[model samples]
Target: MMFTISVPKPGLVRFSHDRTRCLQKFDRTNSVWSMKMEPKFSHNRKIEELSVELPAQPHPPHLESSRDRALQFNRGQPSDKDLDPDDVFEFGGYVAREAMCDEEYWTAAFLRAETHWEDRNRDRYVESHLRKYTDQEFNEIKKRRNVQFGNKCRCIVAMKKDSKDVKRPVLKSMVGTLDLRTRHLVGGETFPEERVKPSNFGSFRMTRSNRYGYIANLCVSKPARRQGVATNMLHFAIKQAKLDELERVYVHVERKNKTAQDLYKKMGFQMIERATPQLEEKQLYLLCLEI
Candidate 1:
């Protein structure tokens, strides 16, 4: 026997066939069925089928750019994106976004500064200043800094008081998370261990001559707060300045924050002998550490 079925709309349909005498036609569109039966109606075949059409969607430009940016960053490639060069300066580690790529491995080490050191430090910066750059720009800065420093530059991040993210850090005092590189001084008969600690920032107070030694926008993410991220950043800066043969390294702390003041003191930093320009009037302590 032979049978045929037709459907006008997209849906599920069931069909049955009897081979006793013969089979016929089933028309779902007209809700009609024709069957020819013979001596026995027990012999039959049944079938069911379903049909559907799906809709299509498009991707947005920003999301695509973000994805591409992440991939490029992961591969240590410079991403094509518009950015404010000054933002790189804020990190105090990257002179330009291009630095991160040349020394991506070292840059990756620097990223460890953000690990959850303390509860407070772990939650803050990631959503604020850290998030400002697409992954591409961030990697570029790391690459650029690495290349500029000849892969010897040490880097660190510190947070501001008014910063939206405030958390504890594992380093306990910002002194522990610093990346101290001796690459700059390697030419002077220095070994790996001795290169990490140079004598600078222990005596030099903030002065016009030393202003260039300081960079702005050092920060630790929320997870690594209170763990000495700030102090370690200071130590890293001092190490770099000393590597450049600078006489001393200086940093200005807001007068209101006793915690930072105490931390600097513990790190062998002294209050300025004389505050010039706006430092005294604004109550910013000019702390000097001799290296």
Candidate 2:
């Protein structure tokens, strides 16, 4: 004899064999369905059983936060009400936003290290006769440096929009970053051209009365270079400076970096001072923009 089983509804099953029928209720405790049947014409008995297991459902995707959506879709200039300390700007498929959490700080530190890895190597060789620290030690130092520097400045990071991949983290999409901080000029005047030291090339003595915005460590990942990521970041940083009520914004660039100089010039930056002949090897130039 052949038995047929059918499920008319959840938690219920029907079985039939040659004019004999039986209804079986699924046992939730054991997650199984069992049916027992007795034939009318024979003293022999037969039982048919089958085990059923339901597959586990997957968890739902994470929902994007309102701030994250704003950062991805907001294109127009931000209004005064939108100018928070952690303002975010989006342009074309990229976003420039203030780095807030530890992860973001770490990512920004990594970017800085990548951009100046060659310099680090050269410095190590020059200072320690090529003695090198292990990767773990170097990373730990970078983390400590990030915390120290982050306490003194605001960090802005540029990244591609990952709306399509909400599962991807921010660090994976980061493309560029820059640092903005308030600086004070000694005696409320710019440093003399000949006296500007490499150690304090664009930096001045700290004073509340002569506060100005300083931009430093503007760099884009190699694959994301020449794609306006740096430009957008600069604009965002300048906007932040304006929001902070800074009267002037300054950036120091190597004199040999014509590309950077040209980019800054296009953004209304004017060279205010050049390094002295004694410091020509450093090739640093101070550029300023009046806000």
Candidate 3:
């Protein structure tokens, strides 16, 4: 004899030949299954046959839309869809955002202090021995940063997002920082009064109104160096400067710092003013980028 069974939905169904047993296991959550059957006979005669029909399988979970995949991939963490597109920039698993809250300000201050501590110290031997700053020193830096921020200086921080922390998903830690501020430029002709023979020089005065953006205190964490964080921060600053209606952006770099000079040059910054040797012991070169 032969028996046939049909299932309306996708599930597991079992059958036995000797006792004509029909066992049905239904699970709404599961859409796939595997089956195994073994027949038994008492008298070594003709064995009974049984057949079962199962519904078609559902679509695979991996074959989802790109948006769905992104949502699923960033389930608990903050995503670009949740942020203001104008304020945040995403690149290379990092986000560059404006420093707003107290935690971000403190982090930016700590980054600046930690990276530029050696430059502040005059004595190289003493600097080499110092590993970190005291709490008072950090607080002082933070205070100075607060004053600058109050004075129209904008600070951008490159943050590495941590998806593991559901409480704080956006800014886990700061990798780099850059500050932008408006600066006034005055340009004209000046003649020395100590000229031995002052000829009939044409009295021509050239004065133009020039206001531009200035970038300063750009630094990245030691561990995050050489990973394009600095480049990304500079790009963000340029975009911000354009939004502020500034036509030119300038940066002052140490004369001996070839690495920084090369980076600025690569980003289309030209040396506008070379440091004068007679003026100061520590000289800096001024570079400008016309946005």
Candidate 4:
């Protein structure tokens, strides 16, 4: 059930201003995307080039898209192309590219924290700290995560349809969740010292260099399991990275979570050797894939 796909060498990829833009422009005739970069200081367009053969996993079975809806995403989110209301589509259950509304967005945060706790504390954590977050706390988190302030960070949430004594579907629960981290860019300029680089979790840097997106805060509600929600979210995050012209991708998972590790491996990620650190960081496993 594993397969490989050829993509433009990592060099050809460039992050577009729009997230939904084509990941890499492909020459359908050759099905290849290529890019060559000159020296860092070179004005001439001559440099090294490479064609990358990358491992690709298929989209999830339950993942679906709707083209009829107009383009609507979290405002202030970065994207390469302007979404035309005439031609817009969304994937998974009520996926929000960037949820801007404070209520919904905070709900997503609680969704993540609760999912992480996973009833391990029997609702104690949710009732105490995660139930509500102040604006200052949110801003601080965005800063630490390298997410742009005032810019909505990339995210996707699968919603469950619900109704009270009626058949009409009213969205009830935020079941599945995933968060994405792209390199911080503002006004066509790279943010000061805030690149999404390697070496997360225990300071175990990769032995080699890679420009990739960071994936975090993935969860599926207990009732929503096995319905392809997680797979869809992964596809969204990785696709976002590719469109941003990244060379590779990485995520850290808990060592106790074998199911998640297996899923990432199936998607072509390899286990990375991590640097030694405190026991808390040691409990995490880092997995990565070359786009």
Candidate 5:
């Protein structure tokens, strides 16, 4: 006789049988387990006993909470929101520092670098848009990135004892910084140079907030592509915004970058606005996260 066994989805089993063995032999084999023919059992029954007495598996180790621990013991590294712009440039090298000085140069470098990446606007912008930036302008932007980093207060880089000579690594090429206008006011008001214009390309605009806050520039570097650097920067920005007790934090997303849209969605941001007459074919979305 043959026995058949069936198992359900996603599993395996093994069995052995002698095909040449007749029914008589099969019956004899089956009877061995229940056989009481022997008057005295001299062989050891140790194997059966040992098999049934299997040792229990050990438990996994417990993890301790570091949140309640003091800042001195904190193992967390600083996020982009927590890092200074000076540090970002410090790690980014001379060109990175140069990018901070001149908006045109920075824009040119950004546009050139962006071409290789997954930008929504592939070849739409003419070469003319790539502006040459001045050293003074770069310094201003650098100052702003740092000021915003301080305002956010998300994380700070701790100096290592052994690595004192080692240069600080750049957190990201493009870091989004947030400025909290609650405690103090930012001086020297200037109109946005690149205003959200009505165009085919999607543009981001500042959202209306009852509470006071400022949105920092979105800084992207050349070497940091497809590594979730931008996403982390956004997270750090949001974290800082929340710590400042803001009602909401919002960002403008370009209509074309679906990848960015997906990330923002995953991070719990929703599209709140559509394109208006002034905005044109370029759709504008106001993504907000609650503190």
Candidate 6:
């Protein structure tokens, strides 16, 4: 038998008449080809197969960004779609929302300030303040029918979370607290204008009439102090004031506590020394910030 060979066209492939034979692979330049004989494939042979299809959906840009942020923050933990940055403010320690009836906010409020009172040697002053928080007195106070109007104390609380990886058991407790109330919400006499520094009272545009909110009881635990916790709380308060459409926030700082006064000053707060006619007239300062 003789065989004839010629160049194959682009669409044409040569085939041999012999059965049970197949062309495996071929290189044009070398004309090298290799093949291995195996059982032939029948036209009706059954075979297994697999395939997958994914459905696509369009997502808003903000939703994508929010999901990414949530994934990063939760770090493989479960999270809800409703979590928002504005709802929970945190820095060194987490600052939860306004206080509720759940935890002992009132008790922690007194305990946190005990150290300050002792350091100032104001034991008498501490006793005077404790008179209101007495067990019997607080019990009677809580039973009042008009408890809502009983006193104006708004506390924004901060808490430090316990670490899971620590070898020893950790205690999660209140680490910081702040109190605020609009001047109109509670009646009080503000310091005289002559005592306030003019430079510290820069003006901010007010959507509504200008009002001031009293910021009191701002404190952080010793361990959380000097971290960004205090700063975060102060800034968070200012942001809340802006949301309330208030023009300013006012706080009173004792003259003896120069450290806190300095911290306020660094946050752009102006001072107004008490002008009362007494030996301790200058014992306290009124710090004000224009939101």
The regions of model 1 sitting more than 4 angstroms off are 1-99, 102-154, 157-212, 280-283
- Candidate 6 similarity to native, TM-score: 0.50
Candidate 1: Cα lDDT at 17 = 46
**What C-alpha lDDT, on a 0 to 100 scale, does residue 130 get in candidate 4?**
39
The sequence of per-residue lDDT tens digits that candidate 1 reaches over residues 1-291 is 222222122223232242111111222231222334342323221111101111011111132444334432222122223223322223332122212222232233333322322223435564343233334434544453432322223344332222225332211212122333222222121211121223321222222232223333344444444544455556546655654555544456667767767876887878775555455555666665667
- Per-residue lDDT tens digits of candidate 2, residues 102-182? 345555655655554434444645323321222232244334333121123567888666663353354566777777765
* Candidates ranked, most accurate by TM-score first: 2, 3, 4, 6, 5, 1
Candidate closer to the true structure by lDDT (higher is better), 2 or 4: 2
Q: What TM value does model 2 have?
A: 0.55
Q: Give the TM-score (vs. native) of candidate 3.
A: 0.54
Per-residue lDDT of 163-261 in model 4, one digit per residue for the tens?
334232112345655666543221121211222322321212111123346666676666666667676667766766666566777677667777888
Model 2 scores worst on lDDT over the 10 consecutive residues at 47-56
Where does model 3 exceed 4 Å of error?
Answer: 1-82, 118-151, 164-172, 186-209, 273-281
Best by TM-score: 2
* RMSD to truth, every model: 33.6, 29.9, 32.8, 15.0, 32.0, 33.8
Steric clashes per prediction: 64, 0, 0, 10, 14, 0
In Å, residue 81's CA in model 4 sits off its true spot by: 17
Residue 96 Cα positional deviation in candidate 6, in Å, after optimal superposition: 4.9
Q: Write the per-residue lDDT of candidate 5 for residues 131-248, one digit (tens) a residue.
A: 2222233334434433231131122111111233543322222222222222111112111111232332222122123333333333334344444544554555555456444666
The sequence of per-residue lDDT tens digits that candidate 6 reaches over residues 1-291 is 111122111212233373211121222221212333233311121111100110111111122333223322111111222234564576653554444321234334443334334345446665566434433322432242121211223456555543565221111355565666543311122432232333333322221343466676566656555666666777877776776556877776666767777788899999754445421453566678877
lDDT of each: 0.35, 0.53, 0.51, 0.43, 0.32, 0.44
Candidate 6 worst ten-residue window by lDDT? 47-56
The runs of at least 3 residues in candidate 5 whose Cα sits more than 4 Å from the true structure, single-residue gaps closed, are 1-131, 134-209, 212-216, 273-275
